[model samples]
Target: MKQRGFSRRSFLQLTAGALGASLLAACGSSEASQPTQTGSGGGGAQPTTASGSPAPAVITGVTLRVVGTGVTLLEPIREQAEKDLGIKLEYDVNDGPAAQQKAATQPQSWDLYDQWFNSVKIVWGSGNAAPIDINRIQEWDKISPMPKEGKLTPEAKEGDGDAPYRILYVQPDNTLGSIPTEQISMLPLTFNVDSFGYRSDLVDEEDVDSWAILFNPKYKGKIGLYSDPSTGLMDLALGAQAAGLATFQNIGNMTREEIDTIMEILIEQKRAGQFRAFWNSFDESVNLMASGEVVVESMWSPAVTALQVRDVPVVYASPKEGYRGWYGGMMLNKNASDKVLDACYEYLNWWLNGWAGAVVARQGYYFCIPENVKRHLSQADWDYWYDGKPAAEDLLDPFGSVVAKAGSVRDGGDLVTRVSNIAVWNSVMDEHQYLVTKWNEFLAS
Candidate 1:
């Protein structure tokens, strides 16, 4: 069953009122839109050199310190941003929990926060993150409706939990709300729907079409799971329900009893040796699958793509129950100096400028401003990734590894088809701290 925060009619009305114009304009063109040179602190500020090459901005004497998980923090991204923005960058990459801890308690440590939309509650509650001024976003109007309207089209399902639009705008009382405003809680960035990946050589493709397969006794001791409480719990609940073990009224916001019941089931499985390992990082997930220790697991897109590069027969499942959607974005720290803030804004605008978006799109992600990403990609690449068509030529990842070969189509089909089937979203539960406590217990068991 699909979960929702509001009725369908109210949702449509709210999104149409808030984001209809921008969505219509964005999808109207397949061509790239030029950056606008309006607003303060680096909106449309990429000046060209006299020789017809892109020139770096004039920001000087500032280094933007960014904190995020390994998913988005890459050496190549740092080098590209430094070259394009004329500023130095330092990345303190951590796993989900550690990154959130630092971001919530250590505001002095980072100028820009790069993480998922679910962590907005902890960081914003800590008062460490500042509201982003949407006026300074050079391509705000070109962003897709997914983050702003909670669905790409009015008829698409509104997935459960904190869909970015629910917490996107800054309200009059300095809280996040659905109403439109000049300031925002996070600057929308890369995002995609998520599901498990399985080895085609070990598991029959037909046998692994549902989340319940993860809990099947046939795969016991060969399965893997993510270690993060927020996402991992959702995966477990999905499997539990699909396996006919238990049902939750709302999987995203489980009650205390529901949490206990799920934890009990997990503990029983752990003691029975039903899992191989719990991965906490992208590299760990890749290594686990590559080394033949994990036949199946909850997976991110890049991990599946990386395995495909090695000729491993891994298939990212398009589960019958639907996908767990997520969004990643940039947030500002409250402790930034005006100079640093300008530099931060410059970096933020650079992310939406197509170059960075194109890089991540290579790894199975869709950018907010898809038109700009289209400019940086070849027609064949765009058709394969966005149109759900077969690859006309070999498609490579950001790091030059071939992920998809000629005649291969993306696993979930087109972008719209993939997102339209979302069953839930990654969320920060009301009982988040309690959930974490129980998750640790399950890990120990």
Candidate 2:
């Protein structure tokens, strides 16, 4: 799901309006329709420069235009890219859906798209994305075969042939997209898995182990849920799996009747007043948890980490059913000038080699690189991180107080059930609208 505040309906409506405008704009046929160049000159692929050469083959004196959400995690990488690549990196911040709309209208203006997996589909469907030359990117070979196929295949219908969507970027070994670029199209950045975040001060351990805890009568009106239908529906599907109502293997092939059955259980849960608030952003989620407005809620790793940073007395728990997760990669804009493109490649290589990975690990998310970075870290860092060793002194927040433990999945008690199968999620997204409507009706009734 696109991590933005707009409702799904609102986003669709906006896209429809934008499409109409784009069609009208096309009729005018102005120079604006063409891509505007924004970087240093350099065209044909050149031979690799040797180390210590006066001028490395590196693209210089260029500005790479990147457009995406202004999430906090990207800042450090952005700064590093500018320094290491010797090029200016420009960012255009847009919420996920908005990014798609902008890209569709001004496809040539931007060079790279940093977005969620689902938003990537919308961007490609709108014909805003450029075809990636797989042969040019050396790291493409590292990607697993399944996601490679997913990027190549378009979104297929119930019985139609495979979809033919072109993958521009992909996270390595991550199923979120196809085509791995060391930096753009697909370079593994971080692995962020989702699990239930609950108030340890309220819910007991035993009661919170299963998906049923979200619907338990005692916690009615004290739970939180994401406003996005995709997340809520996925959680319900996971719960259905736990209830023996469904399984991941069957989830993809489920008939309408099966989907309706899963929807019914979620509807019933909604009718019971389970959700206290439907959070649409990280700030809102943090406020909800910190204020004690919610006892338990579906949460991503970052949010849990944020809460612990504030000493909210919360714990991220992996229920018996498992956790839902996603991994993201950077994609180069097809419109980027050769200079900017080369700079992007340099940044991408640097990120993968361990610097960016270490920073992400500090934020409680896993980086996609191999495990050797641990050797460079101090004992305290390793213990507090990989080993899940609780801090003897309470972790302090900006305001100065004790912090909560947001346990790692690698730790024994926090085992996460993997949920990265794209085929399964695609099927789930197909049924998302119906699920959301049913859930809304349940909330109303």
Candidate 3:
């Protein structure tokens, strides 16, 4: 769903002959686009003039290869990064699991890895990720304390399960911990609170205000679920608890018995046809919802906006239980050359800079350095997106598609309201391998 907000009508508009290509392109998966280089060729740095005029662009003839999902590897970012930093960028975009697997096992393939904080454990454990020196990041201090202290403010509720701060800093013993340190696993960049999206016109809003909606027999054959083991289990766990089906001492780190219990419940639901489909890609989720096949499902911010752009009457729910949270950032590859690392740093700096942040902000992602992101956004944009104020005019996505009509207010209110309400974050459990085997059994059921 990178640039596609295809509705059922839009989906059918394509010729039958072109359906395969169209679907593939809309998915934005590895096959949708190939790895390509962007940026003009050049090399050299310009020193400041005696008159104090701005220095010219520094062109580093380095082609830093980056591996990540379509979430952050959009074309606009690649073009803008190259334009701003004067370094070539080769993006290898993969889906979530593929990207993480490549980052963990193939450090020699990429210079930088752009992924969520939850992935740091596996990538760092693989010894393929290098620690990011906070001293080198220009806006490190300007980032919000949530990624450093586990809370946006002192009073904010810090959710469990691999919170960004928990795996943030690099300890003196070369391990990741929450304690403050000069080095880190990943440089926090974008984050958002997630919840399910429902067809407002089809379902009663009152009946879908909790994660339990996913387990409700009322919507049995119309429910959708993400297929990723990490997030899908978390969402289900939350729902299972909310629905009085199960409980865990630590929802973040469930015991083997707890895993068995949840899997049993899921398998039972699957056998009963409680799920319409399990989608693994953004396009699949959007298609399922926009086609009215699934009335409610776990969804991302961009996916909701995509549905809105298609005029599908979908609503992003502010679940009473709270939202699922995730934060993403840049991690250097351990095998990158010094030159490649330097170029990677330049690209990283450009991400926190105003332009890239604003581009993503339009799609409902909040950058780490709000100050810089604010600079690049207009008053109305900042108010609607960050301040949670009513929109004075229609709001368009980064691709210039109208997503919100005038007077519309963002769901979940402002940034603080959303982040503070996070109930849990995506996680990699201690028994992740065992969990995977059971997850597969449920899928097969």
Highest TM-score among the candidates is held by which one? 1
The full ranking of all candidates by TM-score, starting with the best, is 1, 3, 2
Model 2 stretches astray by more than 4 angstroms = 1-58, 71-73, 103-105, 131-185, 244-259, 371-379, 387-428, 431-445
For candidate 1, the per-residue lDDT at 432 reads 68
What lDDT score belongs to each candidate, Candidate 1 first? Answer: 0.80, 0.52, 0.76
TM-score of 1: 0.87
lDDT tens readout by residue for model 2, 243-308: 565555444334456667776776666666766877767777888888999988877666876776
Superposed by TM-score, candidate 3 places the C-alpha of residue 349 at a distance from the truth, in angstroms, of: 1.9
Candidate 2: global Cα-lDDT?
0.52
Scored by lDDT, the top model is: 1
| C-alpha positional error of residue 22 in candidate 1 after TM-score superposition, expressed in Å | 37
The residue ranges of model 3 lying beyond 4 angstroms of the native Cα positions read 1-59
Off by over 4 Å in 1: 1-31, 41-58
- Over all chains combined, what TM-score does candidate 3 have? 0.86
Q: Give per-residue lDDT, candidate 1, residue 159.
A: 80
Error of 3 at 205 (Å): 2.5
